[model samples]
Target chain A: MSPRDPSPGAVGLGRRRFLKTATAAGISMALAPLRSAYGQAGAPGDAINVALVGLGAQGRVLMDAMLKIPGVRFVAVCDIWPYARTYGQRYLKKNGFEVRAYENHQDMLEKERDVHAVIVASPDFWHAPITNDCLRAGHHVYCEKMMSNTIEGARSMVRTMKETGKLLQIGHQRRSNPRYLVARNRLLGEAHLLGRITAVNGQWNRAVSADLGWPNHTAMTPELLQRYGFADMHQFRNWRWFKKYGGGPLSDLGAHQIDIFNWFLDTTPSTVIGSGGRDYYEGHEWLDNAMVIYEYRLPDGMARAFYQVQTTTSAGGGYFEQFMGTEGTLRMSENPKYTTINREAAAPPWDPWVSRHFLAPQKAPAKSDDDSSGGSEKVDARETAELAGYYLPVILTKAIHQPHLENFFNAVRGKGALNCPADEAFKSEMAVFKAIEAVESRSLVTCQPSDFTA
Target chain B: MTESTNTQSDCGPTLGVLLLRAWLGVRAVLTGIEKFSDTRTLQVPLLDAAGKPDSSGAVVEVTQKFYSLHSYHAIPDSMKDKFAQEPLLPSLLTTSYYAVLGWALIALGIAVLLGLWTRASLFLMGLLYVSLTVGLILIKQDAGVAWLAIHVALIAVALSLCRHNRFTLTRS
Candidate 1:
């Protein structure tokens, strides 16, 4: 007798298969709108293809961070340095990723048709060419900071992205940091908390020196060196010290603080006046200590922002922002602590009973003026003033980097607008550019939007 | 029999000779353009307070002019500087020579691509390459000089490959 034909459920196979298939189909249907909204969303459970062009310090850190996110696969990597290529490949392989690698970016762009996005962390000189090629090849991009070494390169990059209708997210991580977001919100949203902010001060100080003996050698060949505006290996490796490859401290460190200043003021500075030079460090082409004063005119009035960055000295504590106002002052930083201090009262107290009793109260026989009532009044005033003088608010935030990454991925999926778009980056770049100009010219430099245009 | 033999042996112009002439012609035209183009008059944004163009704007204007002449596209207005600084005649002449050389090169590139004036165009392009390369090197504009070097090398290779004036005005 044929074994009684097992029922579908009893067979433990047909029903389960049907359920699995149904679930997948349902998910695809549910995610259809999301896929349409976001420009590109890979299939469910499919790895998203990505490539990293630069494997420098920051580039490696970004790769580690991207690996933490699910559904990502590093498909290809490119760097002019052979070591960077092998390093990236080994890291990916150790993490179970099968990545093809290329020494040249053009070749990678040509070969990697399935690549959905690319992360560019190459030197400033290569940013424009790599980014333009990536966009033209129809891939989204996450480029590292200081979009390009030159304004022309930056303009060309922006133009290429616009023409190609591609997405580019600059590597300004503070825009993604939750602590900075909280501080930004408090400064802009709580109008009276810091009174009317009339001035701001920002400082970023470090203890780097030319004598530190850091590897200041570049690996470019003589031919390449001549072609790319580098005088030599030292100039290329320590590009931050030169005007050709970088904007020095103003572009390196000042960019972050300047962005914060713009965030707080809700407006860009109309003009920037700057002074300071390479007073401390020797053998460096860029300024070791510099200060820039930016005057931002808001709808209410004008405000001043002073930025001081020093690389030689270690004496540093004000590594934050101080907002000054008529009524109080607010000091804040990314450390999650915000403090405010109210102004002291300008007038002294007067006795109320003297007017009612007589023009002047006759001296009471032997009773002192410092009685309990007067003393209590003084104590109360003191307590009130003390309470009003300072308020410290500590904000608690979960990691913001993950959320920022999530936002970028979501934007790729068409879920939201970019937190920091190219236009905003252009503004930030312009501010930094003007700061450098001011330092170079030794005078005030006005920043118009047109200054950044091609 | 002797007369017929002589007529049969008579050799007209060889392909090598024809190619050399075509190359020379292309070179002359490119050199003329390089000598005649008015690049200094080009305008650019980022003018200094005194109304003179800033360094960045000036460099961009010059580069754009060079590329425009190379690609045969019209120069855009944003590049026009209102404050006309005094012309550097020597520099202007050098720039015009490069411009004409660019057109000539483009014409040669087309001729070579079409196999029309292959040998002559290749030769002319090669000569233009040498002059431009020398000028760029002397000017000490490192970036421009590097690119010019590459172009010169490429033109040299193309010129060497012309067999029998395969494409030349003579052949056309």
Candidate 2:
């Protein structure tokens, strides 16, 4: 008999047959969700009526994420500019949502009084006012962060949320990212994987781009621009660079990462020192490049974080926050490709974590034969081998912003708690305010504990 | 007749052909077998000081390689995605090629080993290596392309020397 033939009366199934069945089962199991969604409606009585108050680029990003969530009905769309207003209305209509379009947010508020939640994605200056009004109107608010251009406006947002007893979720989306949560709650909090983080380095660098311009036919009159606190159509279209309407590159781009520093460190910085200048962009009101160092007082020791935002060059390895500790280093970013963990040579074995499936070991890259620049090996006698990298083994399959929006909408349904609540966000926003102050003063700015309190 | 057969077997070219067949045939069979083999690392939970099984603490054991039909299709999703994007290679064609590749390698490898139609088997094996080289080139894997180029060259040498092949299931 051939080796391939089964013995007589063999009780177990052949390996090939077993594998074929398993493969079929896996494919069927994977497709089950899509099949069921097509056959039925969303969860009963989970309807959430949401109104969007800003229809610009950021607003559209939030809308796209919200569209993927089930049981969310768009009741109204509002923007100050007619072009954005029309674009939002048309886009939502294509997505099967016939929403009321208004050029004034207050007009939409008055008409759509019953919207369960309002997403405030307006310019930084308007975040506090719109969020406060939405809270007062009995709507939960999801406001984008750098919460406001000024500290007082951000404080008012916290005060209003407390007074009105509404959930105010600030859009620091990393707090709700699955990969970040695992790194923070499990690896850092539970396992003590990185053993007393000593320092952090982060940056967001962008190559120079032209000033934003609008279609001449779609330009709003100067009177309307002035009414909305913009100097002219130039300031309105490019509000992010103007001081009156928004913060500079540091506040606009740096806030997202600086907030992560505070959250992961679990403490606000005590001092900030930095310098910045607008040497590159000719007409922009804010600094074109800024570098700031923030010092945090952890319970065990002191930790310092260095952060920079550069609008002129995309040089220093894209955007990521790297935390260096005695035992290891963790580099994290919104992009999963940038997230990685590295062990220090002196640290204890991470074999237990690997066995627990908390980490996946990375295979070393193959050495190239012709790479022969060999001076470093002869110069250092006691040099250690470079540490291997390990992945966190956590994956976020959904769009990055979707989970944060879902967290807010779920909290509105009384099923979950807000990830970045208004009070918590106020504390982080204080650090960003101080960093900008440091840049302007070109000196160290110290913070009092009470200063961060809402 | 027996003396003639003995002389043919002991000749230098016949011995060279025998050694080459042994090396290539073993390599081909093992490569085919590996396509249907896989390994998994499993964690056996460790007990804490209080005698509870700690999910975070465990002993890792790498399982012995086991063969199954599913293992044959364990190509990485990323590679499959790249292949799907290549304009010249349709996904269906790639899929069909992969489905038959392992079995073909094993069958041809056995035929070459037993000296059953040795010349024909060597030529077919060379074609298989050429096809693999094409895939490696499409993926821009320079190292893999180089490795397969060596295999194709060796197969060409083996074909040139296979006229002296003996000790076969069929006379050649």
Q: Which stretches of candidate 2 lie over 4 Å from their true place?
A: A1-44, A372-384, B1-32, B38-172
TM-score of chain A of each: 0.75, 0.88
Error of 1 at A120 (Å): 1.4
Residue lDDT tens for model 2, A1-454: 0001111221233323433554677844323322232123222477888899898889999999999999899989988899999999999999999999987767777887558889999998888777877776667789998888889888888877766556789999998886787677667876688998999989998998999898999999878777777789988889899898888888888988998899999989999999999999888889999999999999979999999999899556889888888888899988877888999878888887776555667767655556677523545667765676887666566788998999888766655467999889998889899999999999999999998898
Docking tier of model 2: it is incorrect
- Reference interface contacts recovered per candidate: 0.00, 0.00
Where does candidate 1 chain A have its weakest 10-residue lDDT segment?
A1-10
Q: Give the Å error, residue A27, model 2.
A: 43
| TM-score, one value per model | 0.56, 0.71
TM-score of chain B taken alone, every candidate: 0.41, 0.79
lDDT tens digits, residues A1-454, model 1? 1101111111222212433554677844323333442344343443567889988776787888888887777899987656667889999999989899887778897887778778888777677778877876767788877887677677766666566556677777677654455445532452234456789888888886553222334355766655555677666567778776777887888887787788777778889999879887667888888899999887778899999888877847746667776554556565533333344343221122111110121222443424445432544454644323333222223333454554566556655555665556766777887888888899989876566454
DockQ metric, candidate 2? 0.05
TM-score of chain A of 1: 0.75
